[model samples]
Target: MLTVLPAINWLSVLVAFVLYFGLGAFWYLFLFPKPYRISLGRSANEPQSGNPLYIVGPAVCSLIITLTSAVLLYALNVTSYGAATLFAAVVGGGYLVTNTVNIAINPNIPRPFLYGLITGSYHFVGLLLISLLLVAMR
Candidate 1:
């Protein structure tokens, strides 16, 4: 499957990765800071500054996820803007949403459905942005 690497747009993948990374930043920082913290059973004001996992884990994971998504998009031959967005919606909704909801249903979850709603929505948005950037860059 990866033998198709030459056909893939590495530049588009990079752009999509960067865009998704930026969206994650704003999504966690400004959009759902308090609610997300509460969902994790943390006080919003609790210090996360010294935690490398808090900072680095997500960033690394985001890059890996974006890379995978880009590979999927390339394999799917997603070309046009409309097709890209549609593919993102279908894949993100079908797979990512289910995964997110499962996390929310975990036995250790603090608040039912709350984190799922936020996290799942963030993933959908990230997928959408990644799609847009990839198609536009093409």
Candidate 2:
């Protein structure tokens, strides 16, 4: 297994968190908002209250996901600098695409296939990036 220096790994983790959140904010606020509104058939002027649970729940989940991926990458003996860059590109980029598609489709009909496609694609790309980062650190 690759042993990553604590300081470097922590820094990388911080970068990852910031990047993910920033991308998410961008996607929601600019990229997907139109599709989301259209999908829900909601007017742009409607008052939408932010739900604490919704915000907190996703934040907690994202933290767990990042930590779990980091641990697994370490355990799997994959830690390198290149891996970090790759992970950021692939995983982060994948989420960007997935969100775009989800907003574009905004399907009214039950579509398990579509849902699975988006979810699976996002997870796969994210894990790939995470794994690459772990491996590179080693």
Candidate 3:
């Protein structure tokens, strides 16, 4: 079967990608640092090492994820806000959040729900905002 690629709105995709990536920076670094550290069972006073990988790695992953989401939205021809939001919510909340919770639930991990809530909610909100931007820009 021959599959035709959709004409992408590059500007929309770029904006959505950046916004989603920025959301993560704000989410973990500043907004919920205390809860995030607590979720990992780390002491609030324990000095965090200035590790570049810890900062850069997740940023890179977020960028890739945002780009992938933008591409999918374009390919799916989601032009309306309602459709875009619905699609994003399904992909983000249903698939991504569900999987995150599941993985975090393994007995090896402590305070699994805390970690799951933090990451899962971020994905859902990030994807929702990305969808909104993509639709509005279109």
Candidate 4:
């Protein structure tokens, strides 16, 4: 654990976290604004509650995901681009995406599949980029 901690490029992890969080901002706010709302059975122009949790919660979650990915990359000694990509696919798809889809498969989410696809895709892409960055920086 001590060896792995020093080996991690902290700056790269910060950058990856920023990229992942920023991508989510762009994704939900700009790219799929309407679709995301529709998935919740809300109108496109419906005003969202100005709740701080809406912003802070996701940021915290993204940070956690980024840190976890960084630790995993270091612990597993992923040293190449191919390995990074494979790591992304397996972790992103197997865990993140699958859990996201499972969460979406609930009565609350009106368009369960669409919501899962959009949200899961975001996590997958973020993981892909973050994993690659971690490997490159390592």
Of the candidates shown, which would achieve the greatest TM-score relative to the real structure?
Answer: 4
Model 4's TM-score against the true structure: 0.95
lDDT against true structure, model 2: 0.53
Better candidate by TM-score, 1 or 2:
1
| lDDT, candidate 3, 1-138, per-residue tens | 112135556687788777887888899878887787777788755666699997788778777776777777777878899998898889998887999899989876677899899989998998899888877886
- Whole-model Cα lDDT of every candidate shown, in order: 0.81, 0.53, 0.80, 0.92
**TM-scores for all predictions:** 0.89, 0.53, 0.86, 0.95
State candidate 2's TM-score: 0.53
Estimate, for each residue in 1-138, the C-alpha lDDT of model 1 and write its tens digit.
676578777888887777887888899889998888777777977654676787678778778877777777777877888898898889889888778989788768787488888889999989888887876776
Best by lDDT: 4
For candidate 2, the per-residue lDDT at 93 reads 56
Task: Return the candidate ranking by TM-score, descending.
Answer: 4, 1, 3, 2
Model 3's C-alpha root-mean-square deviation from the true structure amounts to 2.3
- Taking the candidates one at a time, how many backbone clashes does each contain? 0, 13, 0, 0
Write down the RMSD of all candidates, one decimal each: 1.6, 6.2, 2.3, 1.2
The list of candidate 4 runs beyond 4 A from truth reads: 1-3
lDDT of 4 by residue, 1-138 (tens): 446888789999999999999999999988998898999899989886689999999999999999999989898889999999999999999999999999999899999999999999999999999999888887
Query: Which model, 1 or 4, shows the larger TM-score?
Result: 4
Which residues of candidate 2, in runs, are more than 4 Å off?
1-8, 37-48, 80-138
